[model samples]
Target: MALSRQNQSFRIPCQQCPLREITHLRDFTADELEFVSRFKKGELVVEAGSTILVEGAHSAHLFTMLSGWAFRYKTLEDGRRQILNYLMPGDLVGLQGSIMGEMQHSVEALSPVILCVFERERLLTLYNLHPSLAFDITWIAAQEERILDEHLLSIGRRNALERAAYLIAFIFERGRRLELFDERRFIPLTQQHIADTLGLSIVHTNKTLKKLSSKGLLRWQERGCEILDPEGLLEVAGWTGLGEGKRPFV
Candidate 1:
């Protein structure tokens, strides 16, 4: 359960952001930081299983993930869902909402999340005035597109075992980018999450995961899965992952 929820008007200096201290994230200039600091609205504590951004809704704010996990997904008319991508701590959410005036995909918190909110209207100001910050925004969106491309390839072409392996390795690498890597850390995901993500039935997902486990690639427990050999998973998947970049976190 969520411990508590707080909503307010607050300012967080960009230079002082927690994510900035951890990853090879881009550092903001004084002017840029000031602009972003003023842009910040407040922090939101979102509970796990709560929807953060709803599809087709007009959202006035964009959020930067301060902590915890979320996933972007879309559901069809018959309620068939496709998990698009996992959102890590440093990931930005609601870019589509900010740009298009309505959300195309929904975001749900997988773990209790802390988000840094910023007004959507000021985005054009940053783009028009701060060239570097504008590039960073473009980079962030490009990265998200790249992830979706990978998912499309996996779901469309990869076999069941390879698809499962690819998803684990891909999410783990992303977690590493967020500086959330720890050998002993358990990925807070259930088999059903994997099933939905890979477009597999729950039983098929379990069988695929067991195959990965028996091969010493991962250990899947009741509550979470632990990555044992990422390289092994990469080999199994026959898919190489994305290269790291200096990304912006705000």
Candidate 2:
């Protein structure tokens, strides 16, 4: 759970942020950009498997993912975990903690990650002075709710194979939009991760994955999952798509 905070000198200026170039995110106005530059505290580098935010704790800072991947999850008293959602570059972290005063779920890094830190206390300034940015934050929250709604439907109603296909397809589409997949088209996830997310046993998850692989929908690798035919997966899951349009992030 230990995080490595970089020296303030290492902070990436908001104007030079690589995420701003992403076509899926809205462009920031000059004033907004300047305010964000001043608002950023520094950078934090966390290794894979590190817990970035612990449930029930009040965090002093918020973060924006600059690189790598992470997931939000909650565990029961007996340690059964349910993954809520996955996060990628430009995704905001700890907003709930900032607004609600405590984190309801924990966040863990799936790979080495870089996060832009922002002081929680300064959030009011942004809301008061920049209504547009505040709306963007609201949009981001609504977007998370929308994704959760889809996951709830999958877990509550979809069959085992359908749920697996839906989850994989969901991740693939989001990553594709962010240009995260490389030539390998690999998704950095283990069977256990999939099982937890889908509310299935590890054995059942493995079998379901095998079924998908046999149908040329995806392949399971030692390191992760490889997407072969996203379109076929969508058809199997009976999902339309993530819906059209660029998404906003803070």
Candidate 3:
């Protein structure tokens, strides 16, 4: 797990960030942009399989996902793991650690990742001086809660096949919105990731995925999953969709 930290001279400027061009994210004001530029300390790059944040550790910095994929997970003493959720470009990381003083779950890079790093100590300064940005942070937290609520509903009530369908549809929709998928419609995930996320065994996860594939919904690849029929997967999962529109990010 190689980690690289770039000095501020190499950091991407906030005003010129590519993520800001995404239609789903709100545009920042001149003042807000200037503040964010200063707030961002530098950039951190980590390879796939790198642990960016560890459970029970205190980090002096927060991060905004600049590129690539990551996941939040928690593990038991016996080493059983549960994946809480996936992270994409524009997702904020380490907020829980900043506020709570320690991370409750670990974050790992699913793909080589670039992150915009910010000083955690300056969080309160932002809240005090910039009310709207503070509100955006609160909204981000609320959004995470809503996502977890849906995940709980799926794992607690949905059948194995339905759960698998829901997870695939969820990741596909997010990637589509973020323009992460190419012509191949690939998503970076494995059966083990799906099993951990859905709280199922590896064998059961494989069987459930095969059932979805038989229905012409998705295709499992060597190192990832290809979204073949997103609408069909959503229908099978009984999910309405992400319902996202011009979301905020700090």
TM-score of each: 0.93, 0.98, 0.98
Clashing pairs in 1: none
For candidate 1, lDDT tens digit of each residue in 1-250?
1343657755455667887677567778889888888888888889989889889999788899988998999999999888888998878899998988899999999988988888898898888988888888888898788878888999999999999999998888778777786768578899989999999999999999999999999989876799988889999999777576777766
Order candidates by lDDT, high to low.
3, 2, 1
Residue 2 in model 3: lDDT: 47
Candidate 1: segments with Cα more than 4 A from true spot: 1-6, 9-12
What lDDT would candidate 3 get against the real structure? 0.92
List where candidate 2 sits over 4 angstroms from the true fold: none
Local lDDT at 97 for model 1: 88
Q: Model 2, 89: alpha-carbon shift in Å?
A: 0.7
Write down the lDDT that model 2 would get. 0.92
Candidate 3 lDDT by residue in tens digits, 71-144: 99999999999999999998999999999999999999999999999999999999999999999999999999
Q: What TM-score quantifies how close candidate 2 is to the native fold?
A: 0.98
